[model samples]
Target: MNYELICGLETHVELSTKTKIFCSCSTEFGGEPNTHCCPICIGLPGTLPKLNKAVVEYAVMAGLATNCEISPVSKMDRKNYVYPDLPKAYQISQYDMPLCKSGWVGLSNGRRIRLNRIHIEEDAGKLVHDRGNTFVDYNRGGVPLIEIVTEPDLRSIEEVQEYVEKLQMILRYIGVSDCKMQEGSLRCDVNVSVRPVGQEEFGTRAEIKNMNSLAYMAKAIAYEFDRQVDLIQSGEEVVQETRRFDEGSGCTEGMRGKEDADDYRYFREPDLVAILVSDEMRKSIQKQMPEDPQKRLTRFVSDFDLPEADARLLIEHRRIADYFETAAKGAKNPRAVANCILGQMFARLGTEAEKEQFEVAVTPEQLHELILLLDSGKIRMNLVKSTLEKMLDTGKPAKEFLSEQDLAGMSADDLKAVCEKAVAENEAAAADYLAGKEKALKAILGSVMKATRGRANPQEAEKLLADIIRR
Candidate 1:
């Protein structure tokens, strides 16, 4: 029997706040092992926890961006657990009263992935194992986090990937979290199960923990789906448990039995007061949200006449989108601006780091000027490419580089002279063109372009070459 995969994601996003959630300790990553911690963060005997106002604000911002309803009042609870990474032996998190609820994120195909809740919590410490020795680092113990729990709305691996990417883009665009997977800022717990296609009830689900890579998450989900289906087909029972993906083996290994919510022994925290989001606060945050990426993409396609693929690529990077908008404002043809950005501008960004850094040498105004030049037929496409390279290297405007290098397009007289020289040199090609060999004109145009050092206008030079060949 064929089975359908059902999947849900629990994503933990480390807020970009300057300090830990409950203490004044630094929230910066990769600090000296326990140096960034303190009495409150490491859970000392006499310390009391104080919530960070910024953490709450950022969480609300994220919620608003995702269309989540902000809770007027929410309180924190103690999640009782014992682990080496938990210095406090009990985590302070939201149990029944989370900060936001009932939200949805839209996928590319117009499907909405429903969100169960988004809760604010403190991150646990790290456990470092090296060569049979184990070390605990408390630096990350109290880092502020917002856990976004989604419903089992995703049906396939591709949908899961798209949902994650769109969520990341929204969070990043709102400036709440960087969502850097490599640095552990954004991490996901995937819950997957497989059931017969027509079944109403869900299957025994397995949870995969701490998958930081999206590509690997896709693989792990696929493997888990297959594993569950195989067990059901072969007269074996599928166990509900927690698993870890082994990247080297490309499969998941069982870690431990899954624990239900009651297993955590949650209780209300007495020290901190409940969160209260006033109407003014919510309105302010809602106003602060920029236009959503999807809306911007739609506007780009409609207003600028950009292809959907090109518009999608442009809006993926917020900075690039901003730059494109600024440059496009002054451009005669917005499509040309899109082409230059997607083609010439992207060519200069060689590495992922460079793209992430997004340090373009040319300003939007300068790029607009370059596009205008191209639009006005002042410079050929080939010279525009060379000019862009020089602009990237020197951080100079295109016009300045073109003027300094004398790379301006050749005049009509100069182009005709070069075409004449090409005809005299390539008599066979010229004779073939006169004898109605239309393709031979390409050779003549190439010769003219070469003679003029790529400064000749291609269209004008083609006309000039035809005239010279006919003569």
Candidate 2:
């Protein structure tokens, strides 16, 4: 029987606050085992928790960026659980009164994943297991986090990946968190279920916890869905439980039975006061929010006339989009600037991480200078491309590599003489051109460009070569 996979994702994003959410401890990653923790973060008996103001503002900005409504009033609650990593045993978080509500992120496939809520919470610490011995580190304890819960709107693995990627791009563009999955700054818990095709009701769902990377998450979801379907087909019950993805075997092993809300035993925390976000504060944060990547993508297409695929590449990262706009502002053809970025510059950046960091030696202003050279028609496109490579390699400005002879440009008479010489040297190509072979003209044009050392206008060279071959 055909079955459809149903899935929902719970994404936990660590806010980039200097200090932990409820304490003054450093929230930096990769410190000595417990060096970054403080008495308050470790939940000493007499210590009381204090909320970080930056955490609230950052969460609100994230909500706004994702089309969520900012709650005017929200309060913190206690989520009680006994885990070695959670120093307090009860994490201070928002429950019924979350800071953001009813948000949604649109996917490229015309599907919208509706967010249940975005709640602020504190992160637990790390657990290191070495040689069958377990060690706990509270360095990440009390680190600020925003948990984005989505409804079961994801039906396929493609949608799951696209939704996660879209969320990452939006979160990074707003400068909230780095969303470094490897560092555990961002992770997802996928809830997977499967039912027969055309089944209206969702089958029992299994929760897979702490998927750090997208590729692994996809594999986990695919494996879990099939496991659930196989159970239903064999007439065995599909129990709802927590599972872990076994990377080595590409299978999911059961961890424990899934717990409901009552299992957490949530209660209000008396240490912190009620949180209030006035319209004034919301407006201030809205002003600080960057332009939506989608809106900027539309502008790139409408204003710069770039192809949609190329525009998508530019807007993938905020810095790359910013650089392209800055350079295009001074160029005669914005499309040329876009082409240079999507074609040559992107080739230099080898990986996704490199593309995200965008650590290029060429400055946006220097790229503007290069594009302006093309704008003024002083140098041909081939010169622009080659000079750009030199500028990228040596971190020098375009003027340093562009000699006077290169920018002086070939005069019309000199260009015609060169084209005549190229046709005379390649008689077979010139004869082929006369025999109605259009590609033969390209061979002669290549010689003209080589003789002129890429300073010749391609259009003018092709035209001159065609006229010379006809003669």
Best by TM-score: 2
Local accuracy by lDDT, each model: 0.88, 0.90
lDDT of 2 by residue, 191-277 (tens): 999989998999988899999999999999999988888899899988888889988998889887445423878888989999999
Give each model's clash number: 0, 0
Could you tell me which 10 consecutive residues in candidate 2 have the lowest summed lDDT? 256-265
Model 2: runs farther than 4 Å from truth? Answer: 257-262, 427-441
lDDT for model 2, please: 0.90
Could you give candidate 1's per-residue lDDT for residues 354-458 as a string of tens digits? 655578888889878887887787776777778877887888988677763344556778777788888899899988988889999999888877877787878
**Local error of candidate 2 at residue 343 (angstroms):** 3.0
TM-score of each: 0.93, 0.95
